[model samples]
Target: MNDLGFTDEEIERYARHITLPQVGGIGQRKLINSKVLVIGAGGLGSPLLLYLAAAGVGTIGIIDDDKVELSNLQRQIIHTNDNIKIHKTDSAKKAILDINPNVNVITYKERFSFKNAEDIVSKFDIVADGSDNFGTRFLANDVCYLKNKTLVSAAILRFEGQISSYSAHKGSNCCYRCLWPEPPPKGLIASCGEAGVFGALAGSIGSIQAIEVLKEILGIGHSLNNYLVIFDTLSSEMRKVKINKDNNCKLCGSKPTITSITNHKDYR
Candidate 1:
């Protein structure tokens, strides 16, 4: 129950968005009533939370089990120096509330797993995957497919990033599993902690993820349905490769076989 629903204050607050042909008063109202769930409140989650809150997404759920450490400050912009040691979900809730009191923040200070993924993701109109690991990504994708929820996903490593959207509701499109049929062997991939990622690089990709979520919610723009946009900040290269839905894709293919989230041995 928002008192300022479409008021001059709201119009002024989102004047830029309202002016756009794609998003008028109706679309602004849609945004005010939309619910988005964001997984992980770390580097990629930083900008996604900020921009989505500032854009007036009605309800935003943030899930993260980790606490803010001094090491995370270099990239996790949502947590302040004074907020160190606090749970990331708590820190993100405060930041979102500060950006726009109109947004309702739900904080889950726990990791997203197969057990809780469906329940949490089912509550939102869309889910943004900012997770740093492949296990969580696969889990989120499968859960979203089951729940028929739009999944706006992004991943960043070093100076490169990739963003895409997946939903059976939108019809045939490759899902996370379609891209990587199986998780890389253990120790095959290095995390930002080990490989190190540019702080701004995560921001760039996370912001794009937020935009994709907004577009899906507002039903505006050509959603990234079957394409993956890859960005290389160092070389200043941006590429959008069309992704064909795999006929044998275990997740979203025509004769799909993956019906549940199974703990893959390699993911461990």
Candidate 2:
């Protein structure tokens, strides 16, 4: 092993990354020492977890209170026929380990909610939010902002998907709440299940999420903190829209109302 502590096998495994000027030895090491938490193990989470582990993220935490259903197999590539009826977190962990045995996979067979938001979120350097519900998404944004962690969030419905990174805790960056002040009325937005998502759309968007997470870890290239990316599979088009921080936002505004998880809990 060299001074960076990369084994010969690791060097060989990540030779492509090491050869890149932007992500050389140091960047690969950064990736090998990073901790990332994925908030779901379904469509988006499936590909996101696989890419992260393959890229050598040191520790990965997966929290999902879901069972691997036959329907999930259509989009959740990380699971197989045998995984159906088992906990999604367990199935995902097995997949991650299969991809990279060196990765430390931590599985939480539970939902992401206010009760354990901070406790779980604070443990990771960054969070990838692939949750399908508004409650969990909002909670992740709030907790990530409160804990001063970078959050890369993505969602897919029908033939479209949207992704953005939130770092409002950092300079001039906007939090998720700035984009949608609060969760829409329960029945207003139909979920992927209800609306029927394009199976391949999840992989397309999830791969981008994985790229953003790596960029954040390596501190290389531009960050998506103030920009939102929307992808339309039907037209094969992708658009990046600029978003500005809202001063009146409850979470990250100057007169912020959400300073802690407790504040978020009370407001919710």
Candidate 3:
């Protein structure tokens, strides 16, 4: 093995990454040793998992209960037509291995729930949230915050997408609740089924989310912790705005009200 402990095959596979002055042998080794848990295998999860696996993240855990549907194929590019009806985790695992067999993939064909969330989340070094609904989004964010794991969260609807990374473990920065105190009302909630997301928007936002996760693991470049990136495909405009951790933010605030996961009611 090389000094970085990379096998001959691994060295060749990650040559592009190792060539960068910003990410030499050390950063490549860091990437090969990182463990990341991605919350969904849908649109956003598709590109996130693909990129991370190709980047040589040593271990990746994917959780998704749904089966591959015809509707999912358009944006969830990780699954193929032959894999339709298969569990998303299984299909995703297959796709990730296809990209990089050296990267170990752990799959959970289950939904994120109070009983299992903490246990599942604690197993990974970081979490990338690509869940579609508000309930899962809030649940993932809250659990990551409570578990003190770095969280890279992203969402897309229609032609727009947004992403942010959060870590209350380091210092006072924004958690998902800081940007959104709680899930929206049932009547106000929107879905891709209703609003319709651009097919490419998921790739655009999810790919960046992958970058955020790598940056967090490598401790390179600026972190997106207190920043939110908004992308508008229709207008071809992108905006990055600063946010803050609400002292009253039920979850990570100074006077925190959401001391436990159950306290933040899931409106879904």
Candidate 4:
């Protein structure tokens, strides 16, 4: 164990990262000290949590009110058949600890909503949004923006996925609301359950989300802020589109209308 307090086991475990010029012992230590909050424990959260734990992220917080369902096994690899019917937060915490017992796992057996957003998000350095609904996505972006937390958010539906990081608090970067002013009309966009997501697609996108989160913690590589990445498995193509902050955007615009996070009255 050196002055950094890395046990011999930890040194060996993160040798690959410590050897990298971009992420030597310093970067590994940064990962060890950083805290991240994940907004779901389902498909995207499954791989995202696992990878974050394996990469030696010291503190992880998981929030999800739902229980593991049999259908979740198709993409939510963090849970086994034994975990079915268990709260997703509980199941994901178990999986994270199993991968890296040194990690501090905080489980919130509740949804990430306006009532709890500020209190919960304020505790973490970064947030990863893997939620499946537009409401949750929008709420997370808003709360993270208002709180000045970096948000790494991703979504998967059918064979397509989209991901971006938002740090609108920086003033120059665009928030999710900049790209999407509002949630689409009801019945306009189908849910993953309704549309049938490709199970492997979750792995692909979730892995990338994990990468972006790690990069943010280590302050390495290009940030996805002000940009959105769209992956199409069917076409085997990936597109990185620049997202400019909209002056008319209600949330992050010049004249911001949404100065606070509210329950989705408009979303309804």
**CA error at residue 265 for candidate 1, angstroms:** 4.3
- Per-residue lDDT of model 1, residues 1-268, tens digit only: 1443677778888999888889877888899999999999999999999999999999999999999999999989999999999999999999988989889999998898876887888889899999999888888888888888889989999999999998855666668778778788767889888999999998899999999999998988799988899999989999999887776887777777777766644234
RMSD in angstroms, all models? Answer: 2.1, 1.4, 1.2, 1.1
Candidate 2 per-residue lDDT, tens place, 181-249, comes to 998877888988889989999999999999999999999999999999999999999999999999999
Displacement of residue 216 (Cα, Å) in model 2 is 0.2
- TM-score per model over all chains: 0.95, 0.97, 0.97, 0.97
The positional error of residue 13 in candidate 2, measured at the CA in angstroms, is 0.8
On TM-score, the stronger of 1 and 3 is 3
State the displacement of the C-alpha of residue 99, model 3, in Å, after optimal TM-score superposition: 1.0
lDDT of 4 by residue, 13-80 (tens): 99999999999988999999999999999999999999999999999999999999999999999999
Candidate 1 residues lying further than 4 Å off, grouped into runs, are 1-5, 262-268
Model 2 / residue 171 / CA error / Å? 0.9
Clashes of each: 0, 0, 0, 0
Q: Which ten residues in a row have the lowest lDDT in candidate 1?
A: 259-268
Model 3, residue 115: displacement in angstroms? Answer: 1.3
- Which scores higher on TM-score, 3 or 4? 4
Model 1: pairs clashing at backbone N, Cα or C within 3 Å: none
The order by descending lDDT is 4, 2, 3, 1
**lDDT digits (tens) for residues 106-215 of candidate 3:** 99989887778999999999999998898888888888888999899999999999999999767878898888887888859678988788888999998999999999
Error of 4 at 123 (Å): 0.6
- lDDT (Cα atoms) of all candidates against the true structure: 0.87, 0.92, 0.90, 0.93
